[model samples]
Target: MEQTIPPAESSIVEFKREWTETARETFCAFLNSHGGRVYFGVSDDSSIVGIDKPDEISRTVHSIFKFAIHPSAESYVQTETLKIKDKNVVMVTVLEGSEPPYYVTIKDNNKKGRVCYIRQGSSSYEANDKEIRSLYRKGNPIPYEQRASANQNLTFLTLAEYFKKSNVQFNEGKYQTLGLKDLNGFFTNVGLWLSDQCTAETRVGFFLGNTKASESDGIFTFSGCIIEQFCKIRDLLRNRFGFKNKIEPYTLSSEGYRNEIADYPELAIREALINLFAHRDYSFENAQATVTSFSNRLEFLSFGGLPQGVTKEMMLLGISIPRNKTLADILMRLSAMERYGIGIPTIFASYENFSVKPALVCAHEYIKLDLPRLQQIPSDLTERERAIVSYLKQNGASSRKQLQDFVKVSYGTVINTLRSLEAKKIVVKQGAGRDTKYALTISLR
Candidate 1:
């Protein structure tokens, strides 16, 4: 006959015969680790035979652990009956301990106590001194992933292979090559692996995960809204400013002008991207950096107020502190970052070289960096002067009548404003003949 397996976590079952001390140890291990039901009447081979007196057998097993064991173990014991070989049998069930360190005790070895036991896989092993110490230190914790039994079909191919295909370098050795594998089973069984319990869908959306495994799970993603802003500003640079192909891939190659190059330095842009990526507070879902562009300017807006005990002046003056050290270190090793605490200076220096002051607009929870039109002046001008400058800045050259309309000023007032600006050396006019073009003199310093 096919032997009957014990019922799943049943409070009572059949007991057919005398139980062994090893059987008690197995039940204790179950209680200490994860709770389980033990069928006293069922043989290991699954043949079931009912005990003669179910009540007596239940009391015997109960007294064995509660009063018989040295450190009085607590458990839920239940007695039930089952038919085995056409005879009724008694079953004893033991539930897991709310706390652990459930050891085994025997009548012969009465002096020895605290000899704990735990379940490792299907086998019950004597919990050694070292393992017990580790468990005690850990507070007998249980991971949510393990409790939920996520990724029941966990395969290294599912996670590690993807990294290899992504052009990431990894060791070809045994599973040890993957740091995840090297971590004790404790880490893996606890849901450290990419499992259904901790799926990377939305949680990964706001944060940027490391391409490298040691850093963090690769579930983190740069926010979609932040990337949307980057594209918006980049698009404006191309369409309106006539800055054809201005947003180039990040590279060390020398392109554009030999000396003039692009207005923004490659290092400066790199630092900006890195700073925006690294220093951003991942906890703030609404604070990703936002970039925008207008006719001749590109603006980078980022969430996060300035660092503590610092000011807009200090930020422009090149003071910075990183909030995420682990995330930053992994990115730097992959060449995604240049240096820490130096991005602000690098960005400011990029504009300084162009002789145009980069404006910083600090808000309570956000910072808006405004890049004015390429030919616009760094002005402390009144509203009227600003209007004239903004208008003439884009047109290259404008007639007196055009300037009057653009600046919304009277003919006499327009002439005086232009001459006053020219005298200050902030704006200049050039041309041998009447074909003069007025532009703001680049003097960022």
Candidate 2:
């Protein structure tokens, strides 16, 4: 939906003009601040003038942003047609730039020839020297994870139950002892060590074994830098592997019949999760872990693309290099993991037991584990069986030919499937010879 603008400027910086210097200044201001949207064909007073020639207007706006603006920026423009007073209004939408400090030439000006303009509140103004310095500083802003927030309100009690479950001692005075500077510093201050505040230098956090954070945090979001890495790995796993599964429990039994594949292996799932927790370079200063479930497979992701000197060939051969010694030792003590150095091998073994091969993916920013689906019975059979059961409950009986036609399977396949049903005590035959039919013997939930 198009954002409706009033005939004039509001508190928010929105570009709403047919064509004017003010519109160019507003667009640049929004880019410099929180990226926002600009809509043309609306009066400064917020009336809908609508672009007369949307294509031409679009071309003009693109040229302006591309050629006229200094410190070139990227933006999106969409021309939408709407009905107002039984006439079409062409709406020009401009997305705010990802990078900041965008400006345009104050065309034909008497003063301030090459001055850069920025958004200060609702109005546009020439960026002062201090404002310009601030923008430059923001150009390479500090990552979210490295900076301390005075508002987190976090304490050791935030994850106290986790520590209790692990039987690890959580010294309450550790915060002040380490000179962590605050009760609610960062997970890196307690558990996983990441980069120091502002600089790229890596340092270990206070809590080593994650007595205070969940697997999700240690693997995904301990620090903002690592969290971003987790997101990258997740994307690669989704785009490349295309597997789907759930984070849950399952039991396999061989008492029924042959040829049934287990949904997943217990050992494989644990090893995958543990490998992500144990081996990832949590101090890479800009990486994380990600876990995703899909319809056919499950993905475990690690940050920092692959490791600095590791490749896909090295991974396949069960090569393991421990990244976090302190945290790893603590995990071993808590019995959450082991020192096998064969985590990958264990995961592969689990897949082989389930008659499936999991995929390993390496990208520029992440390493991914992809577990494929195991085929036991046909996927469509569940739906077909459901339809047959409902039909039998309503119609009392069904002939093999009728069932085949209804379910769209071969006659022999339907006969065999029905025979298996009888063996399961779900249905039984009635009548004799050509007059034979099938009826539900007992309802199975």
Global lDDT scores for all candidate models: 0.50, 0.52
User: Candidate 1, which segments miss by more than 4 Å at Cα?
Assistant: 1-266, 287-336, 339-380, 391-405, 408-413, 432-434, 442-445
In terms of lDDT, which candidate is strongest? 2
lDDT of 2 by residue, 1-445 (tens): 4444445554353545465666666666666666444565665565666666666666766777777777665344445656654434555455555555566765755644555667656676778755664565466454222334433344444333434667866564554333233335444322323112222222111111112231111122233222222223333332222123221111112221112223356456667766775566433434435565433456677764554456667667777555544445545645656674677777787776555699988786567897664532222334455445434533456788888887788878788778876776667899988888888664321
Q: What does the lDDT come to for candidate 2?
A: 0.52
Query: Using alpha carbons, what is the TM-score of model 2?
Result: 0.37
Clash number by candidate, in order: 15, 18
What is the per-residue lDDT of model 1 for residues 125-226, given as tens digits with 9 covering 90 to 100? 678755664455344443222232323444444334434544666443533333223234332332222322333211111101111211221122222222
Top TM-score model = 2
For candidate 1, the 10 contiguous residues with the lowest summed lDDT are 201-210
